[model samples]
Target: MRTRLFALAAVAATALSGMSACTDSDDGDGGAASGGGTRAGAGAGKVGVILPDTTTSQRWGTDDPKLLQAAFDAADVPVDIQNAQGDKAQFQRIADSMIAGGVKVLMIVNLDSATGKVVLDKAKAEGVRTIDYDRLTLNGGADYYVSFDNEQVGVLQGQGLVRCMGGGATAGAEPPMIADLNGSPTDNNASQFKEGYDSVLQPRYDSGEYLKGPDQSVEDWDNKEAGVVFREMWEQTNKNIDGVLAANDGLGNAAISILKKDGMNGKIPVTGQDATVQGLQNILAGDQCMTVYKPIKKEADAAADLAIRLYRGERPTTGDRVKDPESGAYVPAVLLDPLPIAKKDINLVIKDGFVEKKAVCAGRFAPLCRDAGIK
Candidate 1:
């Protein structure tokens, strides 16, 4: 099951990357005026955005809203962005309210893929075009989906762990023992990430080059729950783990906290994603192997453009369709490439304007950030 999940993450990441790159050449500036459609006369309708949760990561509060807001403002479209706080019933109620409010475009980062389908169905019935943001609403049959190359996220995590383990075998020594702490079971991106990481790690495990430890899928990407789960795994396995393949930075941080309490901070190599401030701090401290950086600005801008197009009844330039697992139908999607950030390239994210120097270089991390050339 672990291997299968990893493979799926890889495929989804690759597909998303290809899609994101393909759309880069098209100039989508000037908001809704550039697109052709019936509702193109000024701002004809409102765009509704529903986010999954705020407690999971910093991106929800900082990056996601800012990027989406900038994009929508540039497109001259009115947007209403709401957070469900990880509540399924609340998410449903929010979507229902948006539909009743006569929203023309509905963009959502689904908390659960199954619940997302219900929201999408409701939107469709109400004649509202839906875009599955970040988390794909596969069975929901959304009009469009936008997100990073999720599988590549896994590949970077997997490759980083291998590199952190010293790249080559140590004189007839068996490969390092690693644990897999993945995201929620319902999140499609989690499966995609597992696929990418497993693509690189599974072969080693099968060949007896790397040892496998307790592999578990985290529920709802909860950091506290992840910490508890890792603690239990450590107790059960007697701390035999050498490396950890944590699906995202939140879980990685959770596992790292547990390892720290056990006096195993820098001893075990761990992988992460999102390139968040806390995650980057861990990387600088040499506690994390690496993180996959998906620029939120670009992703949010693209999603906003797509939403505006849909609102104006214009056909988007998306040419590919991803097959939904539940309905077995092709769903339109936009996939973006993800960058791998290591200690060496920590400055790159700063250079690319993904993160601000002040945001990452505060408090005790200032010296570390300066040493890392993070200006």
Candidate 2:
């Protein structure tokens, strides 16, 4: 399969005579960076990467930054990658330091729209080109935006939930009462995800094929809070809530934990995204229905490519742009397709290097993995 990050290969600038690719093979010319932007090299400017809290997903801290750093390592450019840890104030402080340290490019997965605007504005005033990574900054504006086709992510999640609920057009059947534990209200991707799933669910709801239950966005994709909130919603309705429309793997796991307590794990349909280790394990063990897999390597690579171009004083080009709802600006974007992973589709991620065969097939999961033809 063609790597999704290869979409902008042609637009990769060839001006770096001293650059190197991340791999020795034909992985394309846009891979290398210096030991540090401070090191004596041809591309001497650092790129700033500010990821939102690690509580929401492990990828932001453990996986994504490493991928981006590897690509930067190949390009001989330096990067300052840091995590905001869900604190808006910390996010601003980190951005301020990056800008003051003379980073040429700034990429962020914002904690919320309010503080994001402040950081992005500061970066712009300092002549730092900004790229909205994973989450858009709304009206804050940026040089580019890169992420998965989040709406499609919701479509997959919604469809998965419906299937798990035994959805059909049979007349007079009452649809399941589903709880929507969406992501943080501060993030734009959360809203886009809702838009995607709502496209599928609202129609079903309108036709009386699905019943809307308690629907609320988590404050910061807080799993602990998700558990508390969902439990209250479900218990308040006398445990009549039939299933869940969880926004991501974290929330799904949160709800699954609650379901396990009530002996409802895998008994009712639940949907998720991000395909985290916990989410996949839940799927293999028959505790969760599915999780959408958005390859972090592809996303980080694309963001790194854009950042490299910006740091090199090259005008990066992208034909596709995502509309900023608040500003009405069509910010250039490279939105990749997300894969829906069920019990059957586990091998695709393993084969594509998105997950470890060892991680998926270890110990208790061995039999389940073998049963799924993972071996």
Candidate 3:
């Protein structure tokens, strides 16, 4: 592995000599997180990263890039990172550009498995070591994977919703009507989340303890589209939804928006993930039931350590292996645990620096933050 990495780097360095380096100013560039321009001959041997988009979750645009960049910088590694901004064609273009520019290591948070397979396959063909940052590429076959235990994230979501709905196996005269607004159907993490949550919720549905209501997936985890889909669900059920199992904070907030229109925000318990600022505030406001917080800094540091070692032609080892359902292959993985955050746990997110106190405590959330014992 070490010998092949150096050979690939030598070839890339030779190839990059003739190419004009490009900067973050280039079209479709989310801009470099560590340094400007992939064209820098000095950085041609550096690791390259491609983020999915700035939309679906705030972490993609703001949190992950910042944290990942800091990790690489602290290790004194020259890295170039950019976001695809949700365009498949653009994602390919960026990957091709990075490969041609001579990056020995390539990392990505895939837009989807199909597109991700293409990128990972190309990188592997060029002998460039590949790492799946967060979302796994079904059969893409990257060299390594680093992320939180996603199914556990879903388990927390399901468990949190049950707790918010007043807990216990026994239902009242009428079982609460439950609905689920899942994430993008293309994202494997979404499937894993559904798998975990279903594991917990299915039993309740079978025993007549909870009524399964409208369940649908947002195409791209689009927030506006999420609101539209949820509104139809609300109408289809005649506004009888007693709880919402939203896959993430964005979708959870969308459900809350529709619920607010009907003056039912706090009346219906809703579940979320990502521990986003909006989701945390919603919990404080009594609009959302709970959120799952996967510390992205820890994930980024783990990934960075792997990438740095690979960039230096060192093969790193991981104790965990995740099986790819499609390809039947096991991937070396570094999986982190996730925390469930209710109203009382909101301060934990703040204290951990996952989110800033000013951001969550701003405006109308000030009093709520203080009441929650947030210092």
- The pairs that clash in candidate 3 are 21-39
* Candidate 1 global TM-score: 0.88
TM-score of each candidate structure, all chains considered together: 0.88, 0.88, 0.88
Give the better candidate number (2 or 3) by lDDT. 3
lDDT of 3 at 375: 91
Instruction: Compose the digit string of candidate 1's lDDT tens values, residues 312-369.
Output: 5555545344667777755665666788889889898888777887878888889998
List candidate 1 stretches off by more than 4 Å.
1-43, 168-174
Q: For each candidate, C-alpha RMSD in Å?
A: 6.3, 6.5, 9.6
What Cα-based lDDT does every candidate model obtain? 0.79, 0.79, 0.83
lDDT tens digits, residues 1-375, model 2? 012332433221321222333321233322122122332122555888999877788898789877989999998888999998888889999999887887888899888888888898887766677888988888877877788788889889988988888873467756678889999887888998999899989988888877898999898889999999888887887887887999998888888888889898889778888888778888998888999999888778778887776677565555356778888766766677788899999888889787788987888999999999985
Q: Which candidate number has the best lDDT? A: 3
Candidate 2 residue spans exceeding 4 A from truth: 1-43, 168-173
Lowest-sum lDDT 10-residue window in model 1: 1-10
Number of clashes recorded per candidate: 9, 12, 1
Model 2: number of backbone collisions:
12
